[model samples]
Target: MPDPGSPLARLGVSIQHLLPQRALTALAHRISTARAGWIRRPLIAGFRRLYEVDLDEAVVPASGFDSFDSFFTRALKPDARPPASVGTGLLCPCDGTLSQAGPIFEEPSGGRIVQAKGRDYSLAELLADEKAAEAFTGGRFATVYLAPYDYHRVHVPCDATLRTEIRVPGRLFSVSDATSRHIDRLFARNERMVALFDTAHGPMAVVMVAAMLVAGIETVWDAGLRLRPGRDVARIDFDPTVRLSAGAELGRFHWGSTVIVVTGRDAPDWVDGLVPGRRMRLGEALTGPRAPGRAEN
Candidate 1:
């Protein structure tokens, strides 16, 4: 658990509540989308420097990205990552720090999810749909925190068909560790996009949650998704045709955000050694290979 009385933690939470979050996000959106080299180049360079971004892993444009968004969401080299073989159950969807990972408790009201060591929140509240929340009772979940320097794109962890898309609008508080500890139901209260899918293991949810300065969220299906703030929950059902293979791109966040993956009962065990604070890479096997001796014996 984070230090409850940490002065630094309280400062961040206090600032978020006082700031004009929407207006600031709007301003950030303008700067991120600016195509002019004069506007984008300096921002990209400073960000890369500040984040110690490993440009060697990213495919930089010969000249430069027309906008910081392009650079932030730049594609990797074709051979950047190896394909995720079927043997390794689920693949990680993005590159970031593993904030939390484990089983979802079958609580009386929908279910319960862990936010921190001494913190847990309602699964139903996070999903914004009680029915949808029921499907994940007694399940597995992993929350990845994408840093500003990490790759912005998200990917499928397993073969699955999109079933529904939920747009939930709420506060834009920082998804940082400090805020996650201080903000009550941090995720359940954030503006987010919940993508439900029917995977081989069972029902799955990939929640793309927004945070401070996060301009927009985009899925491969809706590349032009212009996410807007709203009061009501909006859900859209998809046809059966929206299927994607393991490791396929799902979507991306404009700057950076968090992704919470949840699976129904009987979800495969995540690869061992996955503890909070560990850095996870996209396409890495979330499920580990069995021991050769055990398999043979």
Candidate 2:
């Protein structure tokens, strides 16, 4: 929970219930995508200073960026985040603080993932696809939260072929831990892009959840997601040839957001020592083989 004494906490409450989220997000998109020097340069510099972003790890220096969007989704140096030695079942998808991680629980309607202490949201609501949600029943889920200072690009956690991408449009709410405790079904209520992948272990789903002031979400294949209020969920099927190796670039958020990774029932168990609030780097080990005598899902 956020300190009630903090101004940001109060602002979050106001924005969640009172602000026109879509309009604000669209305005942010325009400003972030602008290439004009006067508009973009200062914003980039200001953000860098405010967040204390480390430019040394970036592929290009901050001065070389033409737009705030480019800097926000900048690539890292080749050696900056090399994948952990092979044979680890999964890898961390992005640099962020681990919000929560554990096994999914089955329910009468579907499986449920923890959103925060004492709060859980249904898998069907989170994915917006009932049949697709079933694949993750009794599986494992990890939610990582990216702050403004973290790298916003998300990568593939393991070798997998892209199967489907589902775009679900909803409110652009703040996903900070403070808000998560106060807002019910926060992730399910936000506009998100769900990408399903088929791996040697089984199926995996990477859900990129959008938050307040987040301009857009993009994939290596699709330019950007189209999110409009009142629009029905949109899903795209990928070609079987579309494949990505572990640690390869998968997608990115135009601004900081959250990534929730869910694996199928047959997926490997999470490595020991995982705890909420642990900071993670891209390409680090996330899972290992199941333990002996473990009950099957």
Candidate 3:
């Protein structure tokens, strides 16, 4: 983690605040979604080369995608990311760097989760629901950062039923390492889609945060999520729930972004060696098998 007071980091974040983030992202969306070969093909080819994207892991070949956006969010080969055995804790939700992993602190006013090495953000502000945030008191949270070259789809960590979906509109800031360190409450301040799931162990929330140039975020159930910029929260409560198994696709980012997964108190102990900058892939176990005597909710 970079120093929070670093002058260079502060300057970068200050510059980001002045940029027309939404307009730039909209332009990116327009260009990346272009279907014409002359427009999309070269962009895809250049991106693949520049990022050294692993074509072998992708289900679709580089040339098969109709547009650059499709290529960026392409599905992987079936065997590329296999789920851990049933009892092995919960699965990792995406392919990215483990930016932060630790407990959600029970503060006097509200809950707080680790944002970076030296910063913290409020739990209620993050979920945009104080009651929902209370479920994770003293619980665990893992922050994964998807880069431009990484797989963008997020997955279910365990067998769970979708309980709630929330879209909290905010700034489209860059979620880069420097921004995370310099910008206070970086994840909570960005536009996010919060998915609450009811697992056998307890409630789990996956907060998918958008960054600059991240044109959109869509889930398996909801294809297109278009929200007007505002402070109001958009939410859905599923009475007839959607059950999802470990490794099932939950949602995907249009471009690079961040995901914060928070588990309730009843969840299994997180696996050891969860250090910063640890590279993770989808479906990898985050904890060991469920312990004896732990019952379902």
lDDT of 1: 0.85
| Model 2, backbone clash pairs (residues 3+ apart or across chains), number | 0
Candidate 2 structure quality by residue, lDDT tens digits, 240-273 = 5579988999889888989999998788888765
On a 0 to 100 scale, what is the lDDT of residue 117 in model 1? 68
Looking at model 1, which ten-residue stretch has the lowest summed lDDT? Answer: 288-297
Model 2 segments beyond 4 Å from truth?
Answer: 1-11, 86-88, 225-230, 289-297
Clashing residue pairs in candidate 2 are none
Candidate 3 weakest lDDT stretch, 10 residues = 288-297
Candidate 2 global CA lDDT score: 0.87
Give the Cα error of residue 198 in candidate 3, in Å: 0.7
Per-residue lDDT of candidate 1, residues 1-297 (tens digit) = 446459967976888899999899999999999988898889888987898877776787535678988889898886787766747379899999999988887766658888986788898999888898988877889999998989999999998999998889998998988888888889999999999999888899999999879998888887666565467888889864599988899998988989999988867777666789999989887876545454310
Model 2 root-mean-square deviation: 2.7
